[model samples]
Target: MTQPNTLPQVQPSTTAIHAGYTPSGDYRPLTVPLYSSAAYEFGSHAEAVEKFALRASGFTYSRTGNPTVSVFEQRAAALEGGANAVATATGQAAVALSLLALTQGPKHIIASSQLYGGTVDLLTDSFNDFGIRITFVDPDQPAAWEAAIEEDTRAFFLESVTNPLSTLPDLPALAEVAHRHNIPVVVDNTLATPANFKPLAYGADIVVHSATKALAGHGQVLGGVVVDSGTFDFSDEARWPQIARARERYAGTSLLARYAGGAYSMLVRSKFLHDLGPTLPAANAHSIITGIETLPVRTAAAQSTLLLLANFLEAHPLVKAVHHPSRTTHRHHERAAKFFPRGTGSVLAVELHDADLVPAFIDNLKIIALAANIGDTRTMIAHPATMTHCRLTPSQLAEAGLNAGVLRISVGLEDPADLIRDLDRALAAAEVSGDKSTVKDVVFA
Candidate 1:
């Protein structure tokens, strides 16, 4: 077996293209190849015993690991500057596995208030029913995070760039707060994918990705990944009582001692993935792997185009406000400049003067597609108040800045001029009927 190499300090654009493929022998494939088998043949009973007992490493099932997924995991791990990664079925599954691996009943987690609605619903509602108590804080305030942590707090969660609103939190400060309490910090790096920001490099303990977004670079496949920085000392018995308790439950030693840097990832694989069964199929893994190859190029183009479009939209007469991290009006501008100075990423939101015009605006657009999914090669847009954030209550929607007049734009790899032209025509058509007060009330409810 080959020892894993220590991650080098490398540029993200370079890492995106070349981190994972360590080819051996005469395959000489240009792209990462997929391994389609469901199971692996054991060489002997001893080999099988070692694999089962974790005495040695090998793929036992494609649901857990396969060549295509391994390459994807390796590449993602390298991009996030983590020790290892486990690819899963969706971003929600990735979030579930990361938290569930370290916790069971009666655990506590501190999470950001400005999070994806699905995540808010998961933690505040469903996970709470399962005995996980969550404390929500404004990620904008680092002190709120420190104050929210309890003795039982196992993890602190935040998004690198918050969905829809485009808020960027102070990662280093948040990590410091979590580390002071000897807890791990897991940052959802979906919006700012490693091409723009690597949370682990800024002291985040673990990074989760919704690979369905920019990493996949297309809306065709759905997948997620959890990368372990392997920096936290999980076996420090005084700090991690759960790990100590876990050692007692199983015949194995403390996870830190048994698996070293890979303890969390291993637990996630053997326990969460195995029991929950949110495993990505081999075919989906193959498609996501192919999509990842051009991740850097597509994201770069998208970021640039979004900024240009934001500037145009901000000046347009029909638009009430523009919400992009790079915009001076954004509340999170300072944090965005520090963390994602290259760009605020491709997603932004526009609040219109009248909500009635939203449908007309969307339907009038020629170049951009009106769809719920984002980060595709083709530009897509959505009315989050009516679609993605529909589950949220009026007060909750207002808290997330997802009121009736708001519309989200997921810019794609398209000519900025053509996009602006299409949006110009659409905005004109949307406002042609004039401002209507009836559109101001809650459309989502």
Candidate 2:
């Protein structure tokens, strides 16, 4: 292991390329070689025992570790300015494992109401079976989070930039509140990739990503990662007994004592991942690594295109409202600008004059594809009210600022003119089908 004092600080772009792997002197492989074997061979019986004991650095089973996945994990950690990272089968698993690792017993979690629908389901439905309680609060109000936190509150969760609406939370202020209560802040940076935002840099304790999205940059892979900033002190036994207490399964070793700077990552990998077995495949890790190499360039182009499209749609007669932080009219515009000066992100939501026209508008688009996923090379659109946020109740939808007319667009690396023309034609088609009798009460502001 490289000593912390000897570690070199490099730019994210540089870290993406070279932080994880180095060619062996004999083989001189330029890329991270994929190890497909299910189990690695041990030189001796004693060596196998040592590997199982976690006394040696080597892979024993693919479910636990692999060379390619490790490279991806290391690179992701470096890019996010984290001490370590654990790759998982999907983004949802990353969120689940991170939270589960923190709370093994009955505990409380304060989460932003504006989370991804899938995440909302996990917290409310699935995790409730395990005696974990979640309290959802508005991301815009820091005081709400303060009031909602309880004695058992272990973590505060929110997205850096919300999924469809692009809402920005005061991360630094929230992190301060969480720290004051001895709780860690976990930020999901899937929408605002590390290329655009590093949550840890803004006082976030941990960062999570759906590598299937922007991190992979292509819609071809399914993966997720949990990164530990290594700044949160898990030595507080009362707050985080999972890390501070001795574990019988792992030879009675306390994770915090065993891995001081990387207690969170170590616990997640050794405990949750070991039992749950949500492993990222070696091939998928390779694809994500390749996708990450071009993330900066891809995200920049997509972000610029998103801004142009948002502006175009905001001025259009058929559009009722545009929800993007880049637009000055957005409620969180200033906060978004303060955190993400490079760009708010590639995703934006726009409301049409008629809720009934959403299907037609989506059906008429020629270039943009209709899909549930985001952060792809091709522009993608989805109706959040029916798709991503469908799980939420009617009241939840209203609180989230989503309506039946809202369309979520994930901008891609395409010509701005081509995308604009596609949307213009689609809007014209949608307008033709609109009921003139129902248009009187529709507000365009």
Candidate 3:
């Protein structure tokens, strides 16, 4: 047997590439094997009962747990410096499940005003219908979070770095406020990814990711993960009833009592994950796992390219403003330096001088594709007011810095010179349309 002391602790870069799987058998695979079976056979009836009861850790069904997904979850947890993690079918599912695990009905959540549009829809529509109350506060304001807190507030949620706009939330300050109020902080680190930042390192209690974006690197797979730091004091049973109090899911034993240091994730896996039926497929898990291996190198290059593009765009005559943390004029410039020393992940929002010429600009793009997804190997662009953030109200749009003239660009591994040429062409087209008598303004819902 290989002793634990035989190897020293590895770094995040090494962990991202190789953490979950180990080769031992005569004909072992070098990577995580895809376990596509719907269910697993138990060695004996006694073992089955133990597994079913959550006493023994073994997969009985893929819906709640699978070998491949488990590896992805574990690696994700390790990257985020979490106690454990749970994988879900989609990023939305992971966000929903994380909150659902905290509160049932008629509870409250304090979320950031800078969240993605779909998340806003979920909070205002589905969660409202489910009897959960949510108060959205500007992520920059720590006082707003404290003022919005309620006795029944279960969790505080925000993005480490926001979508469309690369806004940085003061994670440590927000975490301090949430902890003072006895609420746990849940951060969506999708945009930044662990490549640029890990929320747990800055005082976040739980971290969630849209693995579809950067973790999968390629846009081929869709998955999500929830990683808990295990540092939250769930001993306050009155506040965290699901974790501290007895539950029927694990045969009436409390998750905290059953799975010490991993109760939050255990509850998410055994209950919210089981009931919601958003099981991530083994193939998707495998894809995300493999994609994560190249995260560090991919992000390092892409972010450097993005910074150059951002500087170029900012100096352009047709450009109104550039929203990126690395820019010294940006609100979060110092915050980015403090938190994201490696570089902020390769996404930026640029405001054009003419909103009326947006269509001409979008139509002229050649290499940079017009797509809604980010963290891809291909540079993509989307107008937030007409695309991703279309549903956001005018006030919400203003708060998120999503004006009609702003374009969200996801920088990829493409050559910086080629991307610059494409941008130059697009901007020139927009200028030509402005010269004409006929104006073309993009419309949205």
Q: What is each predicted model's overall lDDT from 0 to 1? A: 0.81, 0.87, 0.87
Give the clash count for model 3: 0
Model 2 alpha-carbon miss at residue 229, Å? 0.9
- Point out the worst 10-residue segment of candidate 2 by lDDT: 436-445
Which runs of model 2 end up more than 4 angstroms from their true locations? 1-8, 435-445
* lDDT (Cα, tens digit) per residue for candidate 3, span 60-159: 8999988888888888987887888999999999999999888785699999999888899889889999999999999999998999988899999999
Of 2 and 3, the candidate ranking higher by TM-score: 3
Full-model lDDT, candidate 1: 0.81
What's the ranking of the predictions by lDDT, best on top?
Answer: 2, 3, 1
| Better TM-score candidate (1, 3) | 3
How does candidate 1 fare on TM-score?
0.93
Instruction: Please provide, for model 1 over 83-171, each residue's C-alpha lDDT reduced to its tens digit, 9 standing for 90 to 100.
Output: 89999999889998898776675689998877777788888788988899998888878898998888788999999988888888888
> For model 2, how does the per-residue alpha-carbon lDDT over 400-424 read when each residue is reduced to its tens digit?
7777788899999999999999999
Against the true structure, what is each candidate's TM-score? 0.93, 0.95, 0.96
